[model samples]
Target: MRMKDKVCVVTGGSSGIGEAIARLFAKEGGQVAVVDVDEANGQRVVDAIRSQGSEAILVRADVADEAEASQALLGVTQHFGKVDVLVNNAGVSAVGDVAACTPTDWDRVMRVNVRGVYLMSHFAVPIMRQQGSGTIINMSSTIAVIGLQARAAYAASKGAVLALTRAMAADHSHENIRVAAILPGTVYTPFVEGYLKRHYADDMEGAVETLKRRQLNQELMTPEDVAYAALYLASDEARFALGTALIIDGGVSAAKVF
Candidate 1:
C-alpha cells in the first residue's frame, strides 16, 4: 500500500504502458483516474481495476485537447478531492526523419507530447501545491538521446519532455511538487508495432530480429517494467529525488548498436 489513499491521474490510460501503470497504482491502494479519448477502452481499465477491489474512474479525453485536459482533471479532483500524482503518459508518434517529416506531423507530435503535458500540469500543479506534496512523472524515450533515424517527430517531442521535466522540477521544488521523466527504449507497444508494420511490412520479422540482436539484454522490455519505474518515482520513498531522467533502457542506451 505504498500509495494508500493517494489520488492518481494517468493520461493515455486506455492501453499499453498507461493501462499497466493505472492497474499497478490501484493495486497499491491509490484511487486512479484513467484518462483517455477512447471511452470503451478507458472504461475497461476502470472496470478491471474496480474488479480487483480498487477504486478507479474513467475520464474520456483527448490529452492533446486543452479543454478536455482541464475538464478531466477538474472532474477527477471533484470526485477524488485531491491529486497526489500525475502521470503524463499520452503521446502520438509519426515515422519520418527531418527531411521527410512534414510540418503538420511535427505540430501534431508537439501538441500531444509536449503541450498536452503542460496543459495537464497547468491544472494539476496548483492542486499539488495546495496539498504540499505531489509527483509528476513524464514519459520520455531513449530516442531523446539516440538518433532513431526515422522517428524525428517522436525524438523531438520526448526531448522536449525531458527538458520540461527539468524546468518544472526547478519551478516547483519549493512547493513540494517533484517532477521527473522516464526514457524507455524500444517498448513493444502498438506504437512500435505500427512503425514496424508500416516501415518493415514483409521484412518485419527480420527487423524484429535485428532489433533483438541489437539489444544487450535477451528480452524486450514490457509495459510492466516501465510501470514499476513509475510506481517507484510516484511513491513517497522517492521524495528526495527530483528532476531525474530515470532511464529504463536495458543497456541499449549504454552501448553503440551501430
Candidate 2:
C-alpha cells in the first residue's frame, strides 16, 4: 500500500514499462491514469485494472504534442481531483551514430523522449505546487551515462532528461514537489523487441544475449524491475531522494568485466 490513494499519471501506459508502472501503482492502491496515443491498448489496461477492483482511467494522447500533453494532464486532474505522481515514461528511440542518424530521426526522438518530459512536467508541476506536494519521475536511461553504439539520438534525449530532472529538482524540491529520474538499462519491452526484430532479425536470440552481456547479471531487465524503482520514487518513502538518478540497470553503468 505504498501508493495508497495516490493519484498517478503514467504516460505510455498502454504497454511496456509504462503499462507495468500503471498496473503496479494500482495494485498498491493508487488511482492510475493510463496515458498514451494507443487508445485501444490504453483502454484495455484501464479496464483490466478496474476488473481487479482498482481505480484507473485511460487518457488517449500523444505525449509529444503540446495540446495533447496539456489535455492529458487536465483529464487526469479532472477525474482524480489531483495528481500525486507524474511518470514521464513515454519515449521513442532511434538507432544510429551521429552521421547515420538523419535530422528527421533525431527530431522525432527528441520530441517524444525530451520534449514529452518537458511538456508533461510543465503542466504537472503547477498542479503539484498548488496541492503542496507531488513526485515527478522522468524515465532516463543508462545510455545517458554510459556509451552505447548506434543510439546517438536516444542517448542525447535521455541525457537531456537527466539534466532536466536535476534542474527541475533544484527549482521545486523546496516546494515539496520532488523531481527525480530513473536510469534503467535495457529492459525487455515491446520496444526493445521491435528493435531486435528490425536490426537483428537474422539472429534475435544473439541480439538478446548481447544485450544481457552488457549487464553484470547477464540477464535482461524486465519492465516490472524498473516499475518497482518508480514505485519507490513515487512513494513517500523516497521523500529524501530529491534530484536522484536512481539507477536500476543491473550494474550496467557501475562496473565492467574485463
Candidate 3:
C-alpha cells in the first residue's frame, strides 16, 4: 500500500518496464494512467488492471511530441484530479558509435529519451507545485555513467536526463517536489529482445549470455526489478531521496568484471 491513493502517470506503460510500474502502482492502491502511443496494448493494460479491481486509464500519446505530451498530462489531471507521481519512462534507443550514428537516428533518440523527459516534466512540475507535493522519476541508464559498445546516442540522451534530474531537484526540492532518476542496466524488455533479434539473429542465446556477463550477477535484470525501484522513489518512503540516481544495474557500473 505504499502508493495507496496516489495518482501515477507512467509513460510507455503499454509494455516492458513502464507496464510493470503501472500494474504495481495499481496493485498498491494507486490510481494509474497508462500513457503510450500503442493504443491497443495501452487499452489492454488498462482493462487488465480494472479486471483486478484497480483503477487505471490509458492515455495514448507519443511522449516526444510536445502537443501530445501536454495533452496526455491534461488528460491524466482531468481524470485523476492531480498527479502524485510522474514516471518519465518512455524512451527510444540507437546503436552506433558517433561516426556510425546518423544525424537522423541521433535526433530520434534525443526526441524520445531526452525531450520526452523534458516535455513531461515541464507539464507535470507545475501541477505538482500547486498540489504542494509530488514525485518525478526519470528513467536514466547505466550507460549514462559508463561507456557501452555501440550506444552513443542512447548514452547521450540518458546522461542528459540524469543531469536534468539533478537540476530539477535543486530547483524544486524545497517545494516538496522530489525529482530523481533511475539508472537501470540492460533490463530484458521487448525492446532489448528486438535488438538482439536484429543484430544476433543466428546467435540469440549467445548475445543474451554476453549481456548477462556485463552484470556482476551474470543474470539479466527484469522490468519488474526496475519497476520496484520506481515504486520506492514514487512512494513517501523516498521523501529524503531527492536528486538521487538510484542505480539498479546489478553492479554493472560499480566495477569491471575483470
> How many Å off is the CA of 128 in candidate 2?
0.6
User: What is the TM-score of each predicted model, taking all chains together?
Assistant: 0.96, 0.98, 0.98
lDDT of each: 0.91, 0.95, 0.95
For model 1 the TM-score comes to 0.96
Give one digit per residue, the lDDT tens place, for model 1 in 1-258: 998999999999998899999999999999999999878989999999999999999998887788999999899989999999999999999888898999999999999999999999998998899899899999999888887788888899999999999999999989999999999988777777887898799998888887777677857778899999999999999988799999997788798655
lDDT of 2: 0.95
> Given candidate 1, what's the lDDT at residue 31?
98
Model 2: per-residue lDDT, tens digit, 110-160? 999999999999999999999999999999998999889999999999999
